[model samples]
Target: MTISFSELDFLKPELGAEFTGDGVHFAVFSAHAEQVDLCLFSPDGKEETARMPLPKREGDIWSGYVAGLRPGTVYGYRAHGPYDPSAGHRFNPNKLLLDPYAKQVMGELAWDDALYGYRIGAAEEDMSFDERDSAPFMVKGVVQDPNFDWDGDLAIRRPWTDTIIYEAHVRGMTMLHPDVPENLRGTFLGMCSDPIIDHLTKLGITAVEVLPIQYFPDDRYLLEKGLRNYWGYQTLGFFAPQPRFMAGDRITEFKTMVKRFHAAGIEVIMDVVYNHTAEGSERGPTLSFRGLDNLSYYRLSPDDKRHSYDTTGTGNTLNVAHPMVLRMVLDSLRYWVGVMHVDGFRFDLASTLGRTRHVEFDRDGGFFDAIRQDPVLAGVKLIAEPWDVGDGGYQVGGFPHPFREWNDKYRDDVRRYWKGDEGMIACVSQRLTGSAVQFNHSDRGATTSINLLSAHDGFTLADTVSYDGKHNEANGEDNQDGHSANHSHNMGWEGPTDDDGINTARARRRRNMMATLLLSQGVPMILGGDELANSQGGNNNAYCQDNEIGWTDWSGRDDPFVDFCGRMIAFRKQHGCLRPERFLNGDNEGPREIAWFGEDGAPMDEEAWGQAGRRMVVLYLAKVGTNGDTGKILDQLLIVFNAGGECELRLPAVNGAQAWTRVLDTGAQAPFEPVAAEETVKVPGECVLAFQSAS
Candidate 1:
C-alpha cells in the first residue's frame, strides 16, 4: 500500500527514516548536492519502484515524508551533483549510496568494478567518471523497527575499580567453541550461550569489551588475497549492527544478548571506530559520504581540496568540525546507548576525535566536551586508545578526568622487566604502582590507566613469549606489515619449540607477567584467549586473517593455565589493597598503603631502586582502607617476583603480624599451593610467589 511521490509531504526535521503511526519521515544532509532522490526498492531489493525527488531543502538538509511506508521497506539514496574530484564533489547518482544512519542494512557489498565511481582501468583515473549503475552491487538500507522489550533489564553500571575488561572478538570468541551450538556459533547469540557465560562467570570478568560489531564491509584487497577483516576495525555504518553477526531479527537479537549479559551482571563495552569509513582514498569508491557531500564529510588537505587529510592512516578522517557531521556522530552514539542498550564504548584512535582547527589534539575539544556533558553518556564508561599517528597524539596522560587511557608504558615496562632487561627496574616500579606518573593528576585516580599486556591489535600471550618478531607473511604483504618494535624475548627460540626447558621458561614468564598485571593498581584488561594459552602461530597483526589464524582454537589445550588465571583474577577481586581508588600516600589526601621491599626484607632504598639489572623485588601491601583510617587494619600480603635465578627472600616484618602463609607459587609444576611461611622462602627463577600474614 505504498503511495506515489506526487502526494508526499515535506515538513520533517529529524534525520533518518523515523516511523510515525502512519508514515515514515526521511532526511539527509548534503550541502554540495544539486538534488537528492529517495530510491525505494521492492522487498527483494532487485527492482526500484519509486524515485521520489526531495521537494524541500532547509539548511543543507533535503527531506520528505512517505505515507504507508512500513518497517520492512528496502531503500537507498542518490545525490545528483558535479563530477569534480578536484573540488571534492564526487557525487555520482548512478552509484546508489547507503544511508549513513541506516539502523539495519539489507545486503552486503559485492566486490565489483561497478561499485566504483571511476572507470576501473582507465588512464584518466578518478577524473574519468563511469556511468555504470552500481545499485546492483551496493548494499541497501532496510527500514528497521528498533523496538524491544527489555523487561526490567538495566545497565550493570559496575564501578571502574571492580571492572575486569575481557577484550574479545564477537565471532572469534565462539566460532570454534565446542560447547556452543553449531547454528548459533559466530553470532551475537553465541556470547550468551551456556559455555561462554559459564567460562566468563568462572573467570570473574565484570565486563566483556567486545571488538567492533558495527556494520563493516570486507575490504576488496583482502578479498583478492583470499582473506577478510577479522578485527572489524574498518566500519562502514556507525548506527547499524552488522547483520552477518545477527542470528535472526537484528534489533531484537542484539537486545536479547545484552539482556542475557545483564542477567549475569556482566556489562558489554563496544570497541568502536568513528574515525573513517570503507570508502577509502582519492581513488576509492563514491559511497554514502562521498556521494552525498564529500567536502563536508571528510577533512580535505588545506593545500589541495582533491586530497584528504589522513592522520588516521586510514585514507580519510571524518570532519567533526562540521556541525552536521558532529550531530550525526552524536546521534549514532546515543542510539547505541539508548536504543541498543550498550553499557560503554572504547574509542579506537580517540586522539583523532579531539583534533582541532589548528591541527592539534585539544583536550578541551568539542567531542570530549559534548560526550562528558551528555545526559545519556554521563554514567557510561569511556576508554581511549590514547594515541594516533598525528602530531602530539601520544596523549597517555592527556585525557580529562573520568576517561581511562590505555597505558602502553605499562605494557612495555612490564614485558621488559619480566624479560630480564638491563635497565627496567625503575620503569617497572612505576608501572607496578598503577603508572602514577602518567595517570595521577588533576584529581584523576590510578584507574584512569587501562593496563593491558596484549590486545587484538598485537600478538596473543602465547606468541609474545615464543616469537621475537611479528610473523605476518600470511597477510599477503610479504611480512612487511605490523609493528617491528616488539620488545619480545623468545627465551632462546623463535616460534614453537619441542625443547621442554624453553617451554617451561616461557610458561613461567607468562605467569610472572600475569601476576604483575593483577597486582598493579590500575584497571587490568586481559586479551580473550590469553587465559586459554591461544596461539596465532606467531602472527602478531592478524587483522586480515579471518580463518583459523584469527579464530579462537578452543580444542584440547592447557587447562591448568586457565584455572590459574581465574584464581588470580579472583584473588585480585578479593583484595582491596591491590586496587585502591587513590594513589599510595602518607597522609589524609589518599590511601597510605603499598611499600616496596628488597630481598633482604628491608624497605627499598635509592640504591635498590637504581639497580637496573635487579630482577627480583618484594611488594608489601597494607590491607587498609583508602580513607587512611588507622582503626581498621587488615592482614598485610607480601608478593615476590623473581625474573632472575632462584633467590631465598627474607620475609618482611609487619607492624603487628608474626608468621606468614604462602598462597601461590608459579614456579612449581603444581601452582596455587599453601605452605607455612618460614623466616626465609626460596623463590624459583622466572616465578611469582605470594604470601599473606597469619595474625
Candidate 2:
C-alpha cells in the first residue's frame, strides 16, 4: 500500500514548501517514547512546535511522515516516556533531543545541565529525571534533500599494490600551511586547495586518508579539563558531517570538497569509528542512540543490565550483531560512497564489528559479509584498524580477503631494527617483504598490509628516537593514559640535548626507518608532519590536545630531514619493482627484481640472520621489458642500506651487467650528483644509497 502525502495526517508545510508533493517522505525510529514531537525553529528564534503522535508503533519503532520539510530546516525531537535508570529508560519530556536520523547538525553543542535528561547533581544520579527544557542547549538536525548532480565523478579505485597513503588530520594539515588562504585554513575547503593538492601530488601519494570527519561532540570530561576532542573519535551523529568543518551551506560544502579532490586524481578515504559513540557508560548522559533505545542500540552485559559492554573502552559499543543496527552502519557507508562520492573507508577499532552475542570473534560476521556482497560498496577500498580493547579483539592478520589492515607489527619491527636491536634481522626481513607469512596463504596479496612506522596514535618519527617513554603531563591524566610499551630506544638521552653524537645517531635512526618504509613491498603510509621532524614532546597519545602540540609547524623548512623525505618518496616512484603486489619468488618469473645480499657480497644465510649486531644491505634490481618481450632493457635501479657503523667490503656484481651509476646518496654533501657506473661509491656509516645500472 503506497501512502500519499495528502493522505498523511501529520503533514505540515513550513520550511520546505517547494518539495512537499515531490515524493520525499520523513520517517523516524524511536522505541521507548510514548509520543515524539517535531519542533521546527524559525530564523528569528521563534519556534513552531508541531505535535505529531506516531501513527504506527511496530516493536518500539515509532515512525511518521511530514510533508513540505526540505533542506536547511531546523528541527528536533522531544521523546516522552518514563524516567527509570535501573531498567535502562532515561526519557524526559522537558529535555530537547536531536533526531537520530539527522542529516546535518547546524552548530556546536553549548554546555549546560539542561541538555541531560536527568538532573545534573541529583542525589540518585540518573535515577531522577529533570523537567527543565533543553531546547536552547541541544543542536537540531536539518533535513537535507539528498540530491546532488555528480557529473562524471567516479572513484579512482587504485589498487593497493600501487597505492601510497598519506594519513593527515583534516584541520591540522592546512591550519599552518603558508600557501593556503587565511580564511580557508582549518576547514574542508582549505585542504582541497591548490597548494595542498600540489604538495600531495608532488609527494606521489595515491590516497589521502583524513581523520574522523563525522559529526562528533566535545566530551564533558574533556571540557571540564580545559581540553577538547580534537581527533573526532567521539562521534555523536553518524549521518551528518561536523558543522565545524563545513565552510558554507552544510551539505553542498562537503560535496564540493569531494569533487575538487576527484578532479585532482586523488582518492579520499575517511577514518570512521562505528565501534562506539560519544554517549559514555550507564552513568553517561542521554544522547541520540542511548536515549532512543538503550537495549537495542548498545551491547549490554547480560550479567549487568545497568552497565554497557565496554569493548571500545569508550564506554559503549554499538551492537552490530543486531539486524537493524547492522543496517544503520551499512546505510551510512553507502550514503558516503553513493551520495558523497567518497573513495574508501578505514574502520577505527574494526574488530568490535566482528564480535557476536557470545562475545566471540566470527570470521563470517554479518557486517563483513554484507559489505563484501554490497554491489555499490564492494568495488571501493576497505581498510581496518584491526583491533580493540575487548576480550580477544586483536585481529591484525585475521581480517577477511579484499581488505587491507594497518600492520602494527610492521611498525614495531621497523622501529626495533633501526634502534640497533640484536636478533631483529630475520624479523625485519620478513616485514620488509610484505610479511608474506601473514597474508600470502589467503586470497589477499602483499597489498593487504598498509605498512607504516608511525601514525597519529603514537609517537611521531622525531620523538620515536628522542624519548624512551610517554611524557603526557600536558594531557592532565597524570601521564598515566597512553601506551606504556612503546618499544622505543633513545640513542643516549631521555629527551632533547646538545650532544652531537646522540643527535647524529637519532638522525641516522630516523633515516633508516624512513628508508625501510619506502623500500618495503607493501603499500606505504606516512604520517602528516613526520616529514619535517614533528614531535609532540614525547606524548604518544595527543587525542585531546588541539593546540600547537598537534598542529604542524612548517618553520623547519630548511632542515635536511624534510629534504630527505621529499627525495625518498620521489625515489620510490622511480623504482616500480619495490612495491610489488606479490612476494619475490627469486625465479625471475616477472623480472630480475629483488636480490638479497649480505656484507660479504654473497647470498644471505640463515646463520647470518641469527647473528647479533649484524646489519645486511639488500640490493634490489628491476629490469624493464615490453609486452611483446622485444624491447630495450630499462636502467636497473639499486638501493644500498647500511644500518651499522662505517665498513668496507667488495660490492656484489650484477649478472650480465657491466656498469652502475650513483643516483642518490643519503650521506652526500651539498649538490649531490649521480656518478658513473664504474665509480666505486663509498657506503656511508648509517645511510642508504640509490644507484642505476646501465650498459
Candidate 3:
C-alpha cells in the first residue's frame, strides 16, 4: 500500500521520514549538494521502486512529501555533487546513504566495493570515482511508527547519591542466560526479561549502564578474521537501535526494554558514541555523512583538507562544532530520552565531544553548554568517559556540574593498593574519600566520581587477580591490543590454576576490591558479570570476541561470590555515611564527619600518611545531619582495610554508643557475629571489615 510522489508537496523541516497519517515527509541535511534524491525501496528492500529528487530546499535541508506512504516504507538517500576528495566533497549518487535521523535501519550492510564512493584497489585510490549501484548493497532506513503502549512507565530518576550502576552489555548479559527464551537471547527483550530484572533487583543495582546498542556494523577487518565487534562502540546511526539487538522488525523492542527496567525500579542508561562514526576515514567508504556533506560532517585536517581531523582514534572525529551536526547530536539525545524513554547516557569518549573548532577540550564548550541548558537533558543522568586518545583529552574531573566522570584514578589506586603496591596507601585513602583532590571543585559532590575496579575495556575482576598481563591474542592483534599496565597481580599463578591456595587468594582479592568499591564515598559501578566471578579467560580486550569468550557464562558462575557482592551492595545502600551527599572534608570547626586512622585506632597524622610501605587504614564515618538538622553525628561506621599481613586492629570509642557490631567481613561468609567494642579484632591480609555503632 505504498504510492510514489504524485506531485512535489511541501515537506516540513523535521529530519528523517515522518509519517503524517496521509503521507511520509522525507528530509535530510546536506550543506553542499547539487541534488538530493529520495530513493523508495520495495517492502522487502530488494528493489528501488522510485527515485524522486526532493523538490524543495529549505536552507541546508532537502525535503519532499510522498502521498499514501505507510510507516514501513523502506528508503535511503543519494546526494549528487562533486566527487572531489582532495577538496573534501565525497559525493557519489551511486552509493546509497542511510538517513542520519533514521529510527529503524533495515537490511544488513553488504560490505563490497560497490558500497564505496571511489574505485577500490585503483592506482589513484580515492581520487578515482566508482559509479556502481550501491542501493543493492546498502542498508535502507524504515519509516517506523512511533506509537508504543508504554503502559504507564515512568523514569526512575534515582539520585546520584543512591545510584549503583551495573555496567552491562545488552547481548553479553543474556546471550547465554539460562532463563531467557532462546528466541529472545541477544535481543533487547532478553536484556529486560524477568530473570535478568530479578538478578539486577536482587543485586541492588539502581541503574544498568548498557553498552552501545546504537546501530553499528561489524568491522570489515574483524569479519575477515572471523571475529565480530561485540562492544558496539563504532556507532553508525545515533537514533536507530542496532538491528542485531531486535528480535523483530519493530523498533519498539527498545522501548519495551526500557519500560520493563523502569517497572523493576532500575534506570536505563545508554552508553553513547557521538564523538565518531563507523565510517573510518577519507580512505573509508562513502556512507551517509561522507556522501551527504563530508566537509560539514567531519572535522577535516586544516592543512590537507582531504584527510579527517581524527581525535577519537577512530579515523574521523565528528564535526560537532558545526551547528547542523551539533543539532543532530542534541536531537538524537532528546529522542532517546523523550521517545525511547531512556533515563540517562554514558557518553563514550566524552572529552572529544567537548572539543571546539580549535580541537581543544573545553569544559564549557558548546556540547556541554547545550546539554546543561537543555531542559530535557539536564534532568537525566549524564556520565562521561572523560578521556579520549587526543592531546589534552584526559579530563577526569574536567566536566562541569550535573555530570559525573569515570574516575580511572580511583580504579588504578584501588587496584594498586590491594595488589600490595607500596606507596599506594596515601592515594588509596584519597580514593576512599571519593578522590576529593580531583572532583572537589565547582561545588560538585563526592558522587561526581563513578568508581570502578574493572570495566568492559579491561580485565574482569576475576581475571584481574588471575592474569598478570592481557591475553588478547584471540583478538587477532598479536596480544598487543589492550592496556599494558593493568595494575593487576596474579596470586602465584597466571590464568586459571588447579592450586587451591591460589584460588582462595584470588577469591579474597575479589572480595576486597568489591568491598572497597562499595565502601568508597562515590557512586559505585560494578562491571556486569563480576558478581558471578565471570572471566574472559584473561582476554582483557574482548571487543571482537562475539562467541563464548565475550558472553557472560552463567553456567560456571561463582555462587558464593555472587552472594557476597549482593550482600555488599545491600550493606552500601543501608549506610548513608558510606555514600554521603557532600565531600567528607574533616576541616570544619564542628565535630568531624570522617577521619582516617592507623591500626592503632589513633587519628592518622601527616607522618603516618607519609609511610610508603603502610597498606592498612581504618575509615571512621559519621552520618552527617541532613534535612536542616544540626551538623552532628546521627550514626557512625568504622571500616578497616588491610592489604598486608594479618594484624590486630583496636576499635575506636564512640560518643554515646557503647559497643560496635561487626556486620561484614570480606574474609568470612555472611551472618557475622557481633564483636565487643573494647576488644581487638584480627584482620587478615587483603580483607575488609565493616562495623556499625551499637548502643
Q: How does each model score on lDDT?
A: 0.85, 0.76, 0.90
Clashes within 3 Å, all models in order? 0, 1, 0
Clashing pairs in 1: none
Candidate 3 TM-score over all chains jointly: 0.98
Compute the lDDT for candidate 3. 0.90
Runs off by more than 4 Å, candidate 1: 5-13, 586-592, 626-631
Could you tell me the lDDT of residue 286 within candidate 2?
69
360, model 2: CA deviation in Å? 1.6
- Which residue segments of model 2 deviate by more than 4 Å? 1-6, 9-24, 31-33, 44-48, 57-61, 81-88, 149-151, 489-505, 558-560, 587-594, 619-638, 653-659, 670-672, 677-681
**Best prediction by lDDT:** 3
Candidate 3 local lDDT, 562-665, one digit each (tens): 88888888888888888788897677667578888888878899999999989899988988685687766777888998999999888876445457888878
**Model 2 accuracy (lDDT, Cα):** 0.76
Best by TM-score: 3
Off by over 4 Å in 3: 1-9, 654-658
By lDDT, highest first, what's the ranking?
A: 3, 1, 2
